[model samples]
Target: MTDAMTLDSYLAAGGVLTNPTNVPPRYRAELMKLMATFVDSELAGAAGFADVINQGPGIKERIAAAKIVLEKTDHADRVLKIMGEFGADTDRYATHHPWTARLDRKADIGATRSEHDMRLAVFNYPISGWTDAVVMNLLMSRAVAEQLAEFSTVSYQPLAEAFRQIAPIEAHHGELALEGAVKLVENGASQDMQDAVDYWWPRVAVSFGRDDPNRFEHLRSLGLRHSTNAALRERWARSADEALKQLGLKSPS
Candidate 1:
């Protein structure tokens, strides 16, 4: 939300970096630049969803979602630009992000598939938000934002600084999604609520990352990541429990 940086010209607000020992001075700019690219790519990916492009539950919802996605994309671009100013490379990296792979699988396609096909293919039958995508957006997007909130404070100065600015934007995005989830449950039958919880619970547990050395632990040690995946998963479990119970759904035992 910095001047000349408020999504107007796609620029991120700059901040002072006092922690130089933990994060490399050279990597600071580069990290932010890469972070921007990631966020921009993330927004673009969200837009590509079939549910996002097509009309969903209503016009107002569709428009609102579109605007949010655009703002996210623009915000990422702004941060990416600022990172460049600090000397971060904008090179894109291939992500071995497991969650994305799971979603893209034929059997586990995202939330927009037709009811019959989704039920037939997806192990989880009803992906709570496939109808509006906002359901999926809310659950999945918020997860990403929650992690990034801590990641923004990573020891890497450039990325940490960029994250400080970007976190609020993503937080807004995450809240919008949660609101949509609330709307979904507003008139949702008891069964529907259960179905939503059932669909998300398993995936949530497995959401952390693959069992590879190239994971959060390594990143944390390098000062690229701030928390361990195991720790994060524990935190995620605690966060999800209350929400599950709120809908009369049982958390994983």
Candidate 2:
């Protein structure tokens, strides 16, 4: 009921910040880190998927894959513009890394970031083929949807609004992936698709991040995060599991 509140109190009370000028130093740093991770992940994911577009089983599948690649790059550009407001050299930042470069598919670098960028670790692994790529797309898209939903409630209004606009597009990508997956299953690739699911499930889950209460406490205090990583991961797992079940695929152990 208080008409006037401190920045901390305002944010804690679900208030929003509309611009970069007034953010606190630590909040700005944290926000930049968060945005960087998103931008880098989208860029890396798009780049990785670009090569696999040709591997899609049919014209429609190829089109879906291609569309996902385009939109993910666009999503990165959208968030990178916000990072630019924080004085980032967006031009250099986008091309600074070899976004197309990825580690071996069997690399065991769990939740670790590459030296060159802040993309989630799941993206560092290479995609094997059409089924593998589609499975990765389906699982990771759901993870992205969950993360974007959490981010849409971020205290930064501009970024929150951007995420809100983006959530459905990202959700649509998941729908496309789901549809492709169903077709793959129908085409007698169910076992191969299940194998791909098993490979990507754990990696995608790790993208939700560690269940660090201390870190979540700091982020939550700033209203940068509205939910715990564990909670978000659980939500994603439940949804992803049901989706997989409907497709006659088993959830990864």
Candidate 3:
């Protein structure tokens, strides 16, 4: 059989590619893009959160925010190492863009990426303060959970394993956000929390990206994607809505 056919059959049968040398050109391109998106998002996320660490209400809250910032940067490094194997300039990649830069909070960019990097559009909005940061973190972390779950099973063995290890750490970040939100609600910040949620919900929702069946199927054939964007977004919406309801906050209509 041809090498392409062999690779196709292998991927179709749930095989995993362990290294960059064996990856086909098209698959390599797609995989690099995937890794770049993940790394860029993590770096930007960490940078953004770092600014809010001092704004956390208490020592514990500040510590949690600091840990998130540290771990997110580490996560970006982990994936960037994988990209490095594919000839990406790991050093230059992390430093070339302004990771801490953000658009005005009221700007509406939808899911479109910024010109300089592949970080998700949601990361382009600034956190208003402690409460707003917590709301954005909680909502966005849930989205990250969904995305990580999908990524953990990718056909690239090394990248998939990296995601598997990173998933629990990211989930812990979500738990911290949940704890912070609950405390804020108990401390009479329920309305503020709701307003932040209203502001962040649609922005976070758009991070799941648009629903395109053809693109999804193409990724699926390469074992780079498993679920449709709409399905993943709907799942995140249900979970996020329930989380808000627990804090006595309603999702924006």
Candidate 4:
């Protein structure tokens, strides 16, 4: 056994290892793939706000509303750092991986995301914030939080640290997002909340991850995934349902 501990070794130890060094090839690949996806996904997501705050009809409240997107992108960067420490090839992840922002730009109807301006977009796609998109993401992020909270217990020191850092901030995100939900009800999405809920319900149920058997072994053996995708997804559905009720919303009949 090498005296130095790498990202893989640390995680694979199941709390038995602690140190940061070189990452194993396969584990590195997985982490890099995961992080790259995350980085791109978040940046893509952030671009949505710029679309809203910049070109759309302006709202005074937008100044603060815009901040959420910025914080989310910053979150992407923080996570990227965790990815980088694991020997992620930033050049590759940056250049090759498609960011979520690009996904927002897709012409496909299902691919289309929500915008702040309701007129230019669908109101209840469960994606456009100006319409009814914000609630869905808020629900999904909250769901992911449950998994991340457990990830904080990863045997890897830095990975554990990363989750710890992100988890606390999520509390505020949940609050602000719920606040957005409240604003959404008052502003317009009140009637559409049901639509948002209905559309988001099935999607969240299936968005967990691949069902491959071997996938869990790698992560669990490595102590990286303390929570399964199914577990988190189930939690998400419950929270989303509860939150919808609290906001005086319901899934479409």
Deviation of model 1 at 109, angstroms: 11
Each prediction's Cα lDDT score? Answer: 0.51, 0.90, 0.93, 0.58
Candidate 1 residue lDDT tens string, 18-84? 4434334434544553464355445444444433544556676676677676766566666556555
Q: Cα deviation of 146 in candidate 2 (Å)? A: 0.8
Lowest lDDT 10-residue stretch of candidate 2? 1-10
Clashing pairs in 2: none
In model 1, pairs of residues that clash are 10-78, 28-158, 29-88, 30-88, 111-130
Off by over 4 Å in 4: 1-13, 16-22, 54-60, 86-126, 251-253
Residues 140-209 of candidate 3 have per-residue lDDT tens digits of: 9999999999999999999999999999999999999999999999899998888899899999999999
Best by lDDT: 3
Which of 3 and 4 is the better model by lDDT?
Answer: 3
TM-score pick, better of 1 and 2: 2
Candidate 4: give the clashing pairs. Answer: 11-222, 40-100, 44-100, 44-101, 114-128, 127-133, 128-133
Q: For residues 179-212, could you state the per-residue lDDT of candidate 2 as single tens digits?
A: 9888888899999999999899999998887888
* Model 4 Cα lDDT, one tens digit per residue, 1-253: 6543554455566653343354556655655555554455556555555555542234634654577677767877787777766655655544453333222322334323334211112212224545444565566567657756766776556666766887777667677667767877777667777666665655555546545568877777766666677777667667777887888876444
Question: Pairs clashing in candidate 3?
Answer: none
Tell me which of candidates 1 and 4 scores higher on lDDT. 4
The clash number for model 1 is 5
